[model samples]
Target: MQPKLPIQCPSCESSLSVTQLSCSNCSTSVSGNYTLPLLLQITEEEQNFILQFFLTSGSLKEMATQMGNSYPTVRNKLDDIINKINQLKTK
Candidate 1:
């Protein structure tokens, strides 16, 4: 599998734009500057949390139970993720 592309620079913390894309099956290529979706900009840990949240039927209580944390903690994390997405959208 291809590795996940970096959306943020590690040094300056700037956004990275995609300049090239190709289909592995057909080898067809496309080139342009493309901004990754906001979802892709978040950390892998946050992505996994999103997956876990969906797998648990989007229940904060269930996520807390699965993660051995409190419901408020899970809710806060979700809130932070949402707020970050919102901020990114406004950019």
Candidate 2:
């Protein structure tokens, strides 16, 4: 399996910057200091949550049912992810 893209420094727990990109087909590479997108800056779990939210047609009720969680619980999780994304946007 392929590894997940790391968004934080393992040592200091700081946000990490993307410094390289490559074209798999052409073997072309580019390198520079680049910040990860706000969504990508969040944890993978959060990303998946957002994706699932979209797949559920943005319905908390459906998400709650599918996740076997209470509606309030699912809503709170989404709120927390929104807050995290907002914070990342400000940085």
Candidate 3:
């Protein structure tokens, strides 16, 4: 089977050459070169927030409740993340 491409760095937009890629479901190494957007290059906190947002099915109210923050606060953070993604695309 053809190998999947390597994932790229979100900040630098550099292609990540993985020595071993594994599937979370099967724990199999599906090694290859892949490309991803630079926006993935974020701090752990940011990553967690993103993951939580997605895991919560993009429910801002849920995120706010879970994060113990206001709706506007969660929205601001999400907006900031989106802005960063947009900037990277333009670059």
Residue 33 C-alpha lDDT in model 3: 57
Q: What value does the lDDT take at residue 34 in candidate 3?
A: 48
Q: What tens-digit string does per-residue lDDT give for candidate 2 at 1-91?
A: 9999998899999989999999999999999999998888888888898999999999999999999999999999999998988887887
Where model 2 places Cα greater than 4 Å from the true spot, the runs are none
Candidate 3: count of backbone clashes, pairs at least 3 residues apart or interchain: 8
Q: How close is candidate 2 to the true structure, as a TM-score?
A: 0.94
Q: Write the residue-wise lDDT of candidate 1 on 1-91 in tens digits.
A: 9887787888999999888999999999999998988889888888999999999989889999989999999999999999988888999
How should the candidates be ordered by TM-score, best one leading?
2, 1, 3
Q: Candidate 3, residues 1-91: lDDT per residue as tens digits?
A: 9863435565897646445568899887876654444644555567788899989999999999998999999999999988877776776
Clash number for each model: 0, 0, 8
Better of 2 and 3 by TM-score: 2
Best by lDDT: 2
Clashing pairs in 3: 5-33, 5-34, 6-33, 6-34, 6-35, 7-34, 8-36, 10-38
lDDT of each: 0.91, 0.93, 0.75
Worst 10 residues of 1 by lDDT: 2-11
